[model samples]
Target: MSKVFDFSGVDDFCSGGFMHTNPKDSNLFFPLGRHVDVYFPRKRSHVSAPFVFSGEVKPQPSIEVLPDECLFEVFRRLSGGQERSVCASVSKRWLMLLSSIHRDEIFPAKGNLDPEEHDNTSISVKEDEAFKPKEKVEFVDSERVKSVNEEFEGIDSDGFLSRCLEGKKATDVRLASIAVGTGSRGGLGKLSIRGSSSTRGLTNLGLRAIGRGCPSLRYLSLWNLSSIGDEGLLEIASGARLLEKLDLCHCPAITDIGLIAMAMNCPNLMSVTIESCTNIGNESLKALGRYCPNLKCITVKNCALIGDQGIVSLFSSAGHVLSKAKFQALDISDVSLAVIGHYGSAMTDLELLDLQNVNDRGFWVMGKGQGLQKLKVLSITACGGVSDSGLEALGGGCPNLKLFGLRKNLLVSDTGIVKLARAAVSLESLQLEECHRITQCGVFHILANCGGKFKALALANCLGIRDINFLFPLTSICHSIRSLIIHNCPGFGDVGLAVLGRMCPKLTQVELSGLQGITDTGLLPLIRSLEAGLNKLNLSGSVNLTDNSVVAITKMHGETLELMNLDGCKYLTDITLSEIAQNCSVLTELDVSKCGITDSGIATLSGAEQLNLQIFSLAGCSFVSDMSLPYLGVLGKTLVGLNIRHCNGISSSSIDLLLEQLWRCDVLY
Candidate 1:
């Protein structure tokens, strides 16, 4: 009975003999104690089997009091993710016990589902499903995830790697457990502590433990950890010699001294991100350029101390191999731009934002220089320095530029677009936003000259494109335009939309979000004109949109559509949902948020045999209540993400009931 006692309110769990479980925290740990060969029930039946007393005070057996062999049996029998979650929620003791169980200890549910479905397979699977599952794709693999052999390729085979602590769970005790546990397990490959926590719970003591134990660590990310300082970082620099990637954000305690130490020690670094760390300056970046030659990607944002001297020095040595770079809110001038243009021979993608001191001459020098011929992508945002002449210079410099994006630039006019199109013959796609000075003449120039290779165009809040037909003739038809996006352009009425229908006939994906002026009359023609058939269509925030446009779209192009969003289309009802369910055969994602959808609408769609959605959103659908929950359960097998936010009519108990029923889906209520 003592073993089965409640392990609650025991604040100093390390000194006392109980687990102080934080219900809200994701990361869990156990205090140092003697081994008792922990175990659990083997079967769900054993867990639920109530004592049937024979009218006597016979002691009942508890899981906590069971033998070690019996405990391991129950843990083994708990195969599915749903069952494991239920077990963890039973009490704090189970959580701490489960923390020590390694990947090899738990066996997968062999006859049945994937890794996600098999709960007892690995701590990797458990952590993935339980903590930050949304960061993963819709049951798809992330490109960042490396194979087992590649993850631990050069390192020794004596470290148990990979631990992530976020929100309230990032603590010193958990860090200590990770540091000590790696000795018995394998080597540490990756570790990350993110977001705000309980009074900056992790400090130098915990980080020092990790540095001493984890020498094979390859990747590390620390964000918003104000308590951890240069001492802890120096320890990591001296101990973790195989570190490859480092990401630091909003970490006020870290400075150039700490980062320089890492750069000098870890020569194998391939990628680095530094954001909002005011204390870090050019010295740290210089160390990276001088020591880390294998680096490929560099991102620096909101670091005011990084001026032209720092950028020039960093790129001078690292520019030969660097391929991707992004700089935002930096105090750099034309000197940095000129230096980058001179040495950036291998650069492919570059983004520049909020460089207040840079002017048109800097861009002109970048284009007029001898480098940047291999550049494929360039995005500039909120830069007053990028004027018409500056764009002309850039277009002339980068001949192979495939994609260009500009946002919130007040200096770009119609002449710049024409000149840029004239100079850059290989231009493929262009995205423009908040350029009020660029009128229909800019669109005319692009379509006229770059029509052969121009395939995609996205315009947002650009006042210059109101009347496309009035500016010029319709002879410049772009047959290759596969994607077109026009968002929040209320001035673009039916006339402009109809003109677009004839101008772009091969569009495969299109978005007309927040275009309140366009109605069924304007949308029906565009839907009918597409020759390649639509793959994705988003008409969200179209308040005037009704069932007429939706029904027609489904009847024509629903068979090939993979994703559709009609969020905030308040006029839509059950009829539209029924039409979609009956026609969209291969549709995998659907969003009708903020619509007038009711319980009957959900039932009609959920009951339909043709529906097979993996992601569904019903946010702000006030008409929906608890009655729609059962109907939604029909898609439990296919759905991985379900959003029920702002649904006022649904009760909390009902939400809990729905979560239990749809154990596989991530319900965001």
Candidate 2:
């Protein structure tokens, strides 16, 4: 009789005494007393329909369900991963709905789900015509699919199926292979398999499917992913246990057992970029100082088997949490400069130190005093072993130095730029590109004492800079020069462009590329006193600039321009780019490379609609073609980095409509 397990008609029902068909009937009563429904069912239920009590049949209104915080707001809109498997296949009341949520907010613990849930399960199994795939496998494995459509001729159609399934997934392909299967390819938290290096047979199955699907991957970029190796980087240091930024730049089949399996499995690795790997030496810097103890930043560039015992085991193990180090600028020319002069005085918050091709015993071990006053950007380019006593020991030890790049440091002359401009008085940006034994007395001692806190002054190819008289002591002593790059200075002309238009009146960026003795009377009075503090203007290869100096500098400062580089100037034409698109309405980056304009100078830059342009370089302009790409797609919807490299009369269908009107471009060289 106990078989009548009635949950009191179940609405939040509660009852304990069940499963007892009278186990030996030990007076637990329901045996005969109270007439336990007389030991059974008179048709299972008392179908008592005769009572006809019109208002008392109210037993169906028991729906007080929505509890678990309203089932977690319907599991936070069915928490991703294909809407939680389409809300767990919508049934069994949403499979007990969000069965206790929190599994990293319903998935995405690296791969398995979220890649927009494997592209919404490959567009719902390609619109499931009875779960598709009994065919579609032509990505490699051919001899059919019409010889894979003739090896996809000149390819297209997503690059011949992404070069024959580079996303590999076909083993008996189940239901369109569940979004690149193997649990939808591992956790790619920050995995950027850059330039896949011609994928040599799926590079160890994409590094063992990202170490068995991103086990909570933590930033891993195999930059040149050259057929990865060392057993797929020891299966990514034993499956990325929360790795932390590791970029194997030119991954030449990694060595040192993948840096001893990422120093015995990524111990909270911070940043490690083996630039030109070169089989990492010094036992991978003593196994990254015995397992990345919070390594800060280490970039071993052109690693010729890193010397100085791998920079003294990387500054004796992460030189106090190294704030950033890029060695192999010729391995500090075989370490000296007192072995980084006492580790650069204990690297007190080192802020970028690239001893490029270091010499002079690593610049007298980085000029003795080590603590480079909290160095702020110092690059000794082509460090012919620095001279003038390592630029007077880095201008008396980096006094809050502000960017000092000594390019091609051929024994930096002018008494090492007047003792690094009298000990860098907080020099604000100084790059003596191609130093060529600097002259004009170290350019008038940094335009007379750091030109009032100069802001960028690159004397490119400094041929003992001929006069405009150091631009009148750099515009009356650096009136805070906002970027003034003098490329191939040819001793500047127009009397140094009218003494840089009377001492840079707050010059807003200017580069006189190859100044062939500036003309137009020094760019028409320096564009009428830099027409209201210009805004980026570089007359590339200014072959004595013509077209009346670009129509008198776009007629008095083309509406306060915004980035304009007339590359190779070539006697400017097209009426000086249609008077700079009718008075440059705030131009936005325009480089007329090798200009000889055509297509009517891109139809006067399609009437530069208020020039809201965004990076447009007509590389080596060959009289524009492809009919000037539909007028450069009306400035390709606010472009972004579009350099029509070698514009040999544009074709390839004008780069497919300039990549469909620069669809949010990111560098289309």
For residues 1-669, could you state the per-residue lDDT of candidate 1 as single tens digits? Answer: 234223333333222432234432211322212332112223333335453322234355555677546765676566653454334334434433433344345676667664443232234544434532233121122222211121211223333357787876676555544643443235578888896524466787667766765677889999888887899899888878789999999888899989999999999999999999989999988999999989888999999888888899888999998889999999999999998888898899999988888998999899888689899999999878888898899999999889999998888898997788777778888999998887765675676667378888888998766755555566778887899898987787777777778778899999999988889888888888888879999999988989999999898899999999999999999899989989999999999999998999898888778778999999999999999878888876689999999999999999999899989899999
* Count of clashes, each model: 10, 13
Query: Residue 186: error of model 1 in Å?
Result: 2.0
The top-ranked prediction according to TM-score is 1
Can you write out model 2's per-residue Cα lDDT over 1-669, one digit (the tens) per residue?
243433333233333343445544623433333333222222335545432211222234322255657755655454344344333333323323333233333333343534554442233334323322244333223322211111111312221121123222221121111212222222235545555566443455445544643455666766665667788777767766678777777778788777778777888888887877777777887788667878777767777776677677667666656666656443644353455445543343332234555555556556555555666766655556668877777667767767777776667687777677677787788778777778644665566566367677778887767763443433345567677788886876786667656656567778888888787877777677753557778888887677887777666667787888888887776777788888888888888888778887777778777778788887878888888877777777787777888888888877876786767775454
In candidate 2, which residue ranges exceed 4 Å CA deviation? 1-182, 186-218, 221-238, 241-262, 266-286, 289-311, 315-362, 365-378, 381-387, 391-404, 407-510, 513-519, 522-537, 540-547, 551-575, 579-669
What local lDDT does model 1 show for residue 15? 25
Q: After superposition, how far is residue 327 of candidate 2 from its true place, in Å?
A: 7.4
Candidate 2: TM-score?
A: 0.33
